[model samples]
Target: MEVYSYRSDQLAASPKEVFQIVNDDEQLKKIFTILKDIEYSTKGKRSKGAKFRITLGVRNKTYRFRNEITEYVENEKIVMKTKLKQGVITTLFSVEPKGAGSELSVQSSIESSMGVRMFIMTVKPVVKSVMNKEMKKFEAAVISEN
Candidate 1:
């Protein structure tokens, strides 16, 4: 298993506010730069059993992955899992109220076969670096909105 994690510096919004913005597809699209495209299989609100396909462009290569919401807790936690050619990716998002603002953190876990271990390990730092930048971008967007 390979893990990558990041915590936001601090946002001028509540935990619920941050969670809502991150969960909103439109808001996320405005904040995240690496997402090339996203399509939802359903037209319902954000909840468990929702299915979506995300197209990510990284290092000049495009990868499409299907994501299903495995677990969700409003203003608290979200867990999503995806099975890709390289591995099984599981991502967790947690939000907590802090000082007059809020803090949001994301943890990603990748599980792959034996041979891909080295490749995955080498890519971990890159993933963390991107997440760190994205986290800052997200926080800034959320803070500026208020």
Candidate 2:
């Protein structure tokens, strides 16, 4: 498994508010420019078992993947899973209150079959770097909204 983690802080928002923004499709689209579209399978907003199709831009290439929300804890955590061409990907978002704002942490893991391990290893650093940059953008977006 290849693991990558990123963390960011946004001012003047609670953990709940941060979580709401992260889970909101409209808000996320505004924050993540790489997301061209998000299609939700289950209605009524984000929750465990809900599936979403996300179009993302990676290294000048656009990739689409179907992801399922596997775990959720209101105001605290969310976990999602997806199968990509390279492997099984799992992402966890954790939020915690910080003084008058919030701290958000994202942890992503990519597990590949033996045959594809080398591919995953080769891309892990690039993926981590991109995720860190995106997380900073997310923090700025949240702060601006507040």
Candidate 3:
């Protein structure tokens, strides 16, 4: 398993506000440039075990995947899991109050075959750059909400 993590700078928002933005589909699409679209399968309120389909446009190719919320902690954290042909991917999004603001973090674990692992190794730097930018954008969006 290969893991990549990212943390955002403290934003001028509370933990509850950050959590809400991360879980909101429209907010996600607006902040994450690569996120093309999200289709929720779980009706009504979202909670543990909720499922959604995400289509991401990356490097000119569109990849679609189904993700399930495996863990949920209101105003604190959310963990999502996705199964691919090669392996499974798990992502955790967490927030904590820092000073008068909040900090957001993301940890993603990829368990895949050797070929995919090699590809990930090659593109890890680029991914990190993109994730950093996304986090910055997220912070900005959260600040704008205040």
Number of the top lDDT candidate: 3
**Winner of 2 and 3 under lDDT:** 3
Per-residue lDDT of candidate 3, residues 47-110 (tens digit) = 7988988998777888899899998899999888987765678998888889998777889888
lDDT of 2 by residue, 1-146 (tens): 75678776655678877776876778888777777799877784578898878898877999889999899899999899987787778999898888788778888888657756887778778877887777778887777767
Against the true structure, whose TM-score is highest? 1
Of candidate 1, the 10-residue stretch with the lowest lDDT total is 2-11
Model 1 residue 31 CA deviation (Å) reads: 1.0
- The parts of candidate 2 lying over 4 Å away from their true place are 9-12
In lDDT terms, how accurate is model 1?
0.81
Q: What is the lDDT of residue 136 in candidate 2?
A: 79
Off by over 4 Å in 3: none
Please provide, for model 1 over 66-126, each residue's C-alpha lDDT reduced to its tens digit, 9 standing for 90 to 100.
9988888888888888877777789998888889987778888887667568767888888
Q: How many clashing pairs per prediction, in order? A: 0, 0, 0
Off by over 4 Å in 1: none
